[model samples]
Target chain A: MAYEKPLPQPTAIDAPYWEYLRQHELRLPRCQECGHIFFPPNKVYCPSCLSDRLEWVKLSGRGKVWSWVVFHQRYFSSFANDIPYVVAFIELEEGPRLMSTLVDCDQGEIRCDMPVEVVYDDITPEFTIPKFRPIR
Target chain B: MAQMTLYDFKDKVCFVGVGDTNYGALYRTKDPRRNQYTLGVEAFKAALDDAGLNKDEIDGLILVRIPSYQLFADMVGLRYLRAANTFRGEGRMSALAVQYAAMLICSGLCSTVAVVYGNDGRSVGATYGGEGEGSSPYDVLYGMTSPGAAVAHMWRRYMHEYGAREEHLAAVATSNRRHAGLNPKAVFRDPLTLETYLTSRYIAAPLRLYDYCLINDGAVALILTGAERARDLRKPPVYLTATATCTDLTFFYTVDDFFRDGVRRCAEAVFGASGLTHKDIQVCQIYDNFTPTVIFGLEGASFCKYGEGFQFVQNGRISLGGELPVNTSGGHTSESYMQGFGLHAENIRQLRGEAGDRQVPNCQVAMYICPAPICAAHIMTRR
Candidate 1:
């Protein structure tokens, strides 16, 4: 049986972030000058203060549901059986928001500001997708 | 800064040719680029033929999806004297093209310009389902699947924030459907009722099946030339009097106000440039991607004050023969959902007095609002 492989493309700017994902760590670049955290890490300068000094920091993997939607339509063949899935933008404790799928809870139970924690799902041998589940 | 007058570009440029292909459910074979090229070629040929000119005479080309600096010149086989790529929302692409083409013509760098747009949503195999590149990581992580889901989130917020009822939005859908019934090219011409709109299965909370624009494959094109030379063309020229665009930097969150600030700014600027106000606009081709979008635009454009847009439409003020006839060719709601391309083509028809059943009598001026979240407005007049 031929197994389908999920594709992951990483550029130089994002390689470090993806590398961290391999270790089950959520890493983002924080501007030492402005104390701002940015995702999809960039090189050299801070977008906020144009400061060159930056540091990579691991996040707490906890956040609150800022907004959410339940999609009844399947957008991908891989997700066809996963219809009526819940997608949300969670406001992390670090002040940036992350988009992820909500799992382990009924769609009716999801609400704004609901507490959630990140959970990793290993889909393929080399890949893991980040999903969120209600803390309760 | 003085208050700018609206409808001010009296002798700037004019539309010489207009063409469009059928709009319907997604095509099964064509990709987006092919759809664009086919529609571009058809509209380009028709415009050139209609003007009794050749393709080589073209000096400028403007497009939305493809960049001008890319292989567009090679692919289209025209060495443009000038070219522009507009990356804003799709609906405003053509209108902005018209504005840029006019500037090129006015600057003497180009005598003739072609503005084209096309999309084969059906044939592209995506059908609003597949994910594209560079989507926000936040959006992808949360399983934000389609535009419907995102807009539904916004719609729910708007309803909650403004106390807007579902029926208020249903009126817009039903009205567009009623108007589409008179448009021969409209895909879903069956008259829709408020009950039907309300009862339809939800794509997301507070949004019914009818609230969204059908993702159809279609293309529309227009030719822009100097207004002085417009009279010699085969088609009656529709004068491009004024155009303006405004953008809000805040992407998803900043626009949570939903009052359409960018749309209001564009409308005010265009109207100021043309020396005309919303009252002077006899016909309007407002973008209706989602029903509430129209209501938001109507209010934001100052056609009516905020909170009064629903009442204005409820009183039959936007229908044909009403105060301000809108989307007579069914707009995106009933007509083809070529993004905002259908709205522009319909505007041209109205200005030319060629709109059959839905024509507003003696329409001297038409205002087209393309709200991409980033908003643009253009005022065209009968020559």
Candidate 2:
């Protein structure tokens, strides 16, 4: 067995979104009334229209590097060996954003607004971590 | 969308009594009862003493991070309690706290309100990451695990966008340390230089140890009463004129404007309400949870043009007697990181001309800006 890092516990509202990730797909809730798309699969209502009507929809899994950070110090023992790894906010084409590990990307080569695509990794049988790769 | 008129609470309510526990006392002490509650009680008693009023006279209370307000109200032996609420210290607490106090007073629901904050965050072994239970949910897997990491991302982006030099970040840390040297209440008063700042190891790239705030323990309390009765207590009055709070449901571009989003909204609301501009501010006590936060706040509050913040503090302009003397008590970097609680206490002291060595002369107006997911702001003026 491999070491497991802390994983997000999907609540009832967000379970379906995680289920989609298990199938190697990225999706979020789109507000049916106001047509607003949002992330984390936990939103219960349209943030703009104040309507609780929403539906799960697949995202294009595309975005630009809105921002990035390289942690020089290990924040957790699970990541002690992974020092100097990149974490970034992916501003998706559909307007929602997700926080994910940026892999297959050099720390020196990372730039703001760089185009990227999502790649999924099964960290554990119970978890599939969604990561990003630079669009070369 | 209609431009809603925020009911003018300008100069309607004023901070009468303010109190702070001795800095670094509990952070350094191993005493059995050096927790937040005891510190809060001490601060509350100090405020009551400063105001020369009985504890029972306070009809309303607002506490941050110190759970169970009913227990506090009971401990104070206040027979008549009219109103009380708790605001999350994790967000724009200090600014929102003063605003809530003023609103409660003006609405006639509470004649006098006590806004109190107590935190032993660092002393209690609370880690500064996603693992911490009291703050924003961090994604540990992605290394978006702590505020330091998140701010590192923002700082790098800011630097890349504006062409900021390493010296620019160093100047902020260097100048704040000099200010801390003058404040007896600051936790770290040792002098810091540009050379030292440059050499400090990085916690997260683009943000060195020098860029981070100290974790310590302390409590701050302020008493708010109608402006009519403010003249009867304490040294001088710091009026709450024009306060605003606006939240961006998500910062990942769902709310546009990147780092400047919240501050811009708060700045518009506050300045729009009052006839005051950024130039009218004599001093500013911005939230310094991270060094870049100060730079972003300056841009958000319209002190300078977008991306001009790095250049604004060039040539020691943010030091005492500079174009703007920011965080005169070293702020969170050199001072205690009581979140933004200390900034409120600093605002009152500056207005009262009691900031000792770091006092900005003619301190007529001051501001505290907490630019976060929840953008909140407060402006204080002396009449």
Candidate 3:
């Protein structure tokens, strides 16, 4: 079936982030001057030092749940089937945090700071998104 | 570098008129004819009547929720505008509008300013989530849709950081409902209890149905003028003592600091300029778009130490007769969710000692705070 769920429309600033994800590699921009790693990959310059000299560094695909929530109400038709699904803010070991889904885990067992590792969800041939699973 | 301090505009401007559509009357009214501007006009006319001023006297206009100043100005025949602008229909703009209006008046741009807001949200089916509600395409990918979801995560982290239990969140909803019971205009006044709150379905887990605000149709308007001119108006003037705002432009529209740094800055500016501490505030109206927001607002405003807002609200602390009453008008959750517009109006009413049964006695000083990405706060006094 065609992908019915929402996909990130890559822009010029962050297109490489998605392109790398398509290859099952989790990389984010690290500022050369300030060494600040940031997520959503939308910035051309370092948010901390405003340095334009930054490079996409490979990540460990590991993080902890800084915070999380379960969706009991459906706001999007594409997400209706995933009612009660878990979405979380994963704070990567590299220090940047981003929102992604938590899969293959019991909702009742989820707790803040629980160790998690990234897993790829290739919903369509054109796109592959990173989700997380508890590091059991 | 020059040291920057807030230009003190305290007591220079005052709210002369406050008006709104009958919230209780329009709770579920689906009047297709009653659009945003029509509702705005209704509130505008009532504010003019309340101020005992003719619409022709409104030389300045600041609009919220409404799309354009030109559209509203054309409809209301306000052609003498020296200053006029419109804000995006975000709840945070309510206090900003008042602050901006005060600036205009103090700058001698216009003496009498009208800040108007109207929303046909309920009538138009405001989901407050999904594609068009201003979520990025990236956020949609993870099914992170509503504003409540972001707050839920924050609330959960608050729980982890502060050891606050579910009862703390329940207390906020129940107490607001308790206050709503005393408010004739409140929408959900039928005695909410801890049990009821606990059993409420989670719209976003960790933030239950009761945590979410009601989506309803309504409009709110307030008129402002020089404090000297306001004293001669139809009602007692509520002076704008001090106002401050801070912003966080994070990718998620939230911060791990839980908005404390920003809110604390706003608190210092508002209190420092007003010469009033939280103790001097007889009543408060913190923006409660979500119940957790109330917790964040209180902590950020220094009503309690950071991580203790959930505790500060316990044991009737935030009740109408509590040490520091908050959201005595039932706030956005039980009251009509006019975004921050209704809460701002409620604060003015409390300061005026005109809030009917929900009035805080001798409410000489009142404050309003919203601890969102754009954290804002203002202190008002009847004197």
In angstroms, the error of model 2 at B77 is 2.3
How accurate locally, in lDDT, is each candidate?
0.71, 0.80, 0.88
Off by over 4 Å in 3: B1-7
The sequence of per-residue lDDT tens digits that candidate 2 reaches over residues B81-194 is: 788877776746777777778888988989889988888776687667644443233266565677777777778778778888656888788888899899887888889977
DockQ for every model, please.
0.30, 0.59, 0.87
| lDDT of candidate 2 over A1-136, digit per residue (tens) | 7845777678888888777889999888998887899865666877778799899888888899887777787667677778877778778999877778788978888888999999998878877878989998
* Chain A, model 3: TM: 0.97
Give the 10-residue window scoring lowest on summed lDDT in candidate 2 chain B.
B130-139
Q: What value does the lDDT take at residue B147 in candidate 2?
A: 71
* Candidate 1 chain A lDDT trough over 10 residues, lowest sum: A1-10
Specify the highest-lDDT model's number.
3
Provide the TM-score for each candidate, comma-separated: 0.81, 0.92, 0.97
Full ranking by TM-score = 3, 2, 1
The docking category that best describes candidate 3 is high
Cα deviation at B229, candidate 2, in Å, is 1.2
1 or 3, which is superior by lDDT?
A: 3
At residue B68, what lDDT does model 1 achieve?
40
> At residue B178, what lDDT does model 3 achieve?
90
lDDT of 1 by residue, A2-21 (tens): 32423445677777776777
Identify the superior model by TM-score, candidate 1 or candidate 3: 3
